[model samples]
Target: MAHSTDNVILQGAHGTFAKQLVFRQRFGQSILCKRPKKSNLSPTDAQLSVRARFLAASVYAKSVRANPELLVLLVKGLQ
Candidate 1:
């Protein structure tokens, strides 16, 4: 039998993060995105998370519609 976390792995592998695992890990604050030892150029996990959150907020702000009903419908569809 598959473990419960298998579903989460399946979703991560086949869903939007399929092609961007690094970005996904960064958003989740996973150590996978951490800068390598002795590396000075890459952004730290916290920095990447902040940037991802900012981008998400910007997109969500842009997606807000004047019609409250439309937003409700959109949320339902996403679920």
Candidate 2:
């Protein structure tokens, strides 16, 4: 699962053709995906990398916000 801005993308197995997933916050659980055309199959390597980074960053941001003291726990070794 990958997220950016207001949409989330999920790539099953690999970024193969027709495996692109699109989820919008406004959709309220309903997701959409576009099948790759004959000319294009799967996201480019760079695109995948960027998506992964975005997802990681988004998750990290949300996690930190949810638990403001997470850093303290990590640094203090579960005291």
Candidate 3:
């Protein structure tokens, strides 16, 4: 990681650039660094379990959104 200062282009810059570099702000200073490469390892059993649960929750939320009655009931606290 490298600290950036006095660079007009990098001032207040945050996010990835060209998918090769990352710009972030830390402790009120601008930071610039190379983007980390994705891991090649497979997911662990615990990770798979969490992913499955997340998918189920996402599907449930989508179903609720698709059903107007369910959405209104949820927003009105089942009253």
Candidate 4:
């Protein structure tokens, strides 16, 4: 089983592709949805890195909401 943080990191790296894989592996194929192709929106790599971190943090927050125990452990580790 993957830690919630791992899922968030993967999501940050691959976007919907990582999301689909994580959901399918953890929850099953029923959650998988067809992802539309992205349109061209240019951003520098630095900007993309920032975006990825923001996205991962958002996903991590949601996961923490869903599983408070896991969140507690994560918090404890950070401390």
lDDT of each: 0.57, 0.60, 0.90, 0.64
Could you tell me which residue pairs clash in candidate 4?
none
Which pairs, if any, clash in model 1? none
**Model 1 lDDT per residue over 17-69, tens place:** 33434323334333223222355688989999999999998887667776688
Itemize residue pairs with steric clashes in candidate 2.
Answer: none
Identify the runs in model 1 with alpha carbons over 4 angstroms from their true place: 1-40, 65-79
- For model 2, what is the C-alpha lDDT against the true structure? 0.60
lDDT of candidate 1 at residue 25, scale 0 to 100:
34
TM-scores for all predictions: 0.32, 0.36, 0.73, 0.37
Better of 1 and 3 by TM-score: 3
Candidate that scores best on TM-score: 3
lDDT of 4 by residue, 1-79 (tens): 3245434434434335554342234442223345666679899999999999999999988989789899888889899
Weakest ten-residue segment in model 3 by summed lDDT = 1-10
Q: Select the stronger candidate by lDDT from 1 and 3.
A: 3
Candidate 2 per-residue lDDT, tens place, 1-79, comes to 7444433344222333446654333444433456444765689999999999999999987887688598667658756
Evaluate candidate 4 by giving its C-alpha RMSD to the native, one decimal. 16.1
Best by lDDT: 3
RMSD of each candidate relative to the true structure = 13.5, 13.8, 2.9, 16.1
Sequence-dependent TM-score of model 1: 0.32
Clashes of 2: 0
Candidate 4 accuracy as lDDT: 0.64
